[model samples]
Target: MKFTFRKYERINKQKEIDAVITGGRKFFENGLLVYILKTDRNYSRIAILVSSKVEKSAVIRNKFKRRIREIFRLNKYKIKTPVDIVVVATQISVRQKYKILEESFLKILNQNGILNL
Candidate 1:
């Protein structure tokens, strides 16, 4: 089955912030990183952040977002908890392959105890 993260689940509301800030954590790995805040709900959400400082063009930024989303879609099962994940891209990410980026992200999630495997 194909699993997806929708926009409405994103941590945009004040209530979401309170849930995260009171009990959230972060993780980092080569070429990828994540900030995860567990939620009491039963779903996951994602926000892919690519700053213009890394890629000035909107096209490039969107490309980065797409790559991040695709990676998350393929590996969402690794995460066993309901959480909000924010992925912020760096300059090095633009030069890395998708596999490397996905691996790095998974590593971080695993380290943070967010991933079951």
Candidate 2:
């Protein structure tokens, strides 16, 4: 598959904030807490937030975001809805592996009833 979450799927509306924050369920793991909210669309969007306090280097922070994006891209087939997903990385994730991140992410999707299998 072509691993990508396409630009069109990105959520940038102000109205989505509440659903992303309050309505979304939290999925905790060593690296981050993933908050996923279901949207009434045909595709999904992803937002990643990494606190400056977690990593001092901009390059490192960007890398984390890229990794998260890749994870979502590669696993898009497992997801079934056009949900809005926000990934907030904790300090622990800075030192973790990509596989671990993917596992944690998939676990959250399953917990939130967003996965297909």
TM-score of each: 0.79, 0.87
lDDT of 2 by residue, 13-94 (tens): 6567557978987778765788888878788888888889998989888998888899888888778887888888788986
For 1-117, candidate 1 gives per-residue lDDT tens digits of 656666775557656555554566766677565678877778777776677888788887787788888877877777798888877687888657778887898888777787887
| Highest TM-score against the true fold, candidate | 2
Q: Which runs of model 2 end up more than 4 angstroms from their true locations?
A: 13-15
Model 1, position 103: C-alpha lDDT score: 82
Off by over 4 Å in 1: 5-23
lDDT of each: 0.74, 0.81
Candidate 1: residue 10 lDDT (0-100): 59
lDDT of 1 at 21: 44
The backbone clash count of each candidate, in order, is 0, 1
